[model samples]
Target chain A: MAAAALREQLNALLSSMFASGLVDDQFQQLQMLQDDGGTPGFVAEVVTLFCDDADRIISELAALLEQPVVDFDKVDAYVHQLKGSSASVGAQKVKFTCMQFRQLCQDKNRDGCIMALAVVRNEFYDLRNKFQNMLQLEQQIQAQQ
Target chain B: MAGAASAAAERKVTIRVLLVEDEEIHRVLARALMKAVGGVELDEAGNGAEAVRRVREGGAYDLILADRQMPVMDGHEATRQIRALGVTTPIVGLSSDSLAADVDAFIKAGADDFTPKPLSKEKLNHILAKFNLA
Candidate 1:
């Protein structure tokens, strides 16, 4: 896409994401920070952090949940961190799913927690892909300009 | 109004701030906020331990923005260490955890204020105003 077209695409994608409840104001705040021009690619950097942290946390969660005796405290802590990260990056869907996941952990419901993990996983990957795509479009626009 | 403006202009006060964060993006945010507000010099620390070491080394920093969670040492411990070194500069914590307990922990550990992450210009300005820096 051309620079202007890419910019339009980004705006539409973000608006749709917000409208569909896939992301929230936190993501808007991130965009505002990036607009400050003090740090180029600020949004991309935060997205990278969110992606790296989530990937590791998901793997760790899988391992922890596999133990015959689940430690809800550990699970809850991880979920809380993940929720915070999601909130930071404006991954509303992932953050919302993490809230549900945390509740399951608190109830010590192993089955529910497992099911919640899948939901969280799906949300994280979906948002991650969306953000990665957004960043790529931005990079293209920057190059063309 | 004329007298107040002249008095303020006479002093030409400049604020200095220390921004300690593991993430460069956060540092950039703080720096931009400081500049937008004007007349503020910003310093950086990669982690809490570095923050502590810098404070101990001594400089006139009107405020310190410490991220609550860092690899070398967390904000809480860093706050305590700076206080222990007799550094009286105001320290505010930035954390994703804004729970009451978390805020309390930061205060007890020697932070003068706690603001949730990601840090906003409004929050940073509030801290500055509270300290008469802005």
Candidate 2:
């Protein structure tokens, strides 16, 4: 009975995540990955990879933005990668900000890119926090079981 | 006492769920709704590749909700790949597209269900009911 209750709590948590938009289609993709043999913990593994990737891209973007003579091409490339990653994970707001950042890069508007960076960072942080919460909840449920 | 017993009886077993979306806002909202329903264990991934990776690593989930378009991989390719991998977990295609043709494509791609966005609570419940997840 307790196990069943825990599972219900977990599902409710997932639904809340969808409602909040902290995840996207990429999350769904992880679900599908569960079919194959020799691959357990697929969702956690994938999310960790995404978190790592997101962190790296954000740092790279920051470094590029801080350069004295902003390399628009480099910034654009980073933005493109960020956009692709965010889109894959269904981080819509972050992807949208990346789009704007890419445009700013095209225009060579350093300030605009920097501003967009803030938005992307904010979105990423929000997602990170939400994901962390879910992870914790999962842990709790698992412990109880 | 009878009503209480019936209410408890009405509760269903928890269904393992996987949610694939590309939008952050939608993900958060969906998570909240799932939490409210209280009978599902959910995991998430960002794209088809990641989704596939997770499913491969984890055991079979009871349900999968996926978005249509994404960058690293789209939902169609993901669905096809999942089917190819021999995972029989029920999958549902989610999109903002409101066309029957689009819905048909999802079915063809291996999804067992199709849901259109801006997802409403009622609609989500309906999808769950359709899949017997509710």
Candidate 3:
């Protein structure tokens, strides 16, 4: 793709993300910082870390929930971590899901917790796809330049 | 603004900052924020215990940014310990949890202010100006 076309696509995608509330101001802050810092792949690096952290927390939450007797405290802790990570990356939907998951954990509702996990997991995967697409467009733009 | 201890009215060469955060991404964000501030020298500690140790060993930072949650000792304890040592350096707590109770706890533990996680340049500047570290 031409650089101009790629840049236009990126802008459209980002606008959609914001319009859908998939990301929040924190992500915009990151992009602004990246522009100022003159660092290569800064946002990419942060997204990778956020995805890794999310994967780990989601796995641990699943494992904990699978136990015969669930430990609500542990579940809550994991959900809290997920919430923080999502917030940092501006994963608005995922963060909101994690918040609801924490409430479920607090209530000791195993079924509700399981449902919340599925919802948050989907949100994470969806966001990850968007991130991968954004990165790909960015790389193409760089190559064109 | 200059540190109270510094006699010079001119910029204090560099604003020395210590960031205590378990998350690597947050550390990166802090670096960017400080970079925007210009002339900032940053050091990082992954957890609160390490933060306390650095301060105890005479890390003469103009400011400390402490994350509220971590594996080992948390920011609150680190602030309390740093305060116990009679260190007067400004400590600002960082956390994604913005509950008033949490902020109050951090303040009670000796933090001069609180900033939410994924620190923005504006928020950081606000902190720096408020503490006279900018």
**lDDT to native, each model:** 0.81, 0.73, 0.87
Q: Rank by DockQ, highest first.
A: 3, 1, 2
The model with the greater lDDT, 1 or 2, is 1
DockQ of each: 0.22, 0.03, 0.48
| Residues A19-137, model 1: lDDT tens digits | 98988887776677557544577778788878987988898899999999998888887887787678777788998898889889989999999999999999888888888888888
DockQ of 2: 0.03
Error of 1 at B32 (Å): 5.0
Tell me the tens digit of each residue's lDDT in model 3 across B32-126.
Answer: 66766677889999999999999999999999999988879999999999999999999999887788998999999999999876688788878
lDDT of 3 at B19: 94
Show where candidate 2 strays beyond 4 Å.
A1-6, A35-38, B1-134
Task: Please report the candidate that would top DockQ against the real structure.
Answer: 3
| Candidate 2 per-residue C-alpha lDDT over B1-134 given as tens digits, one digit per residue, 9 for 90 to 100 | 23323422475466788888765645755664565455667788888888888887865788889987766988888999998889988899987554799899999999998977645446667877787766
By lDDT rank, best first, the candidates go 3, 1, 2
Q: Which stretches of candidate 3 lie over 4 Å from their true place?
A: B1-12
lDDT of 2 by residue, A14-131 (tens): 7877787767665664454333222445556545655777898899989989989998988876676666556545566677787777778899998988999988899899887777
With candidate 3 superimposed using the best TM-score fit, by how many Å does residue A54's alpha carbon deviate from the native? Answer: 1.0
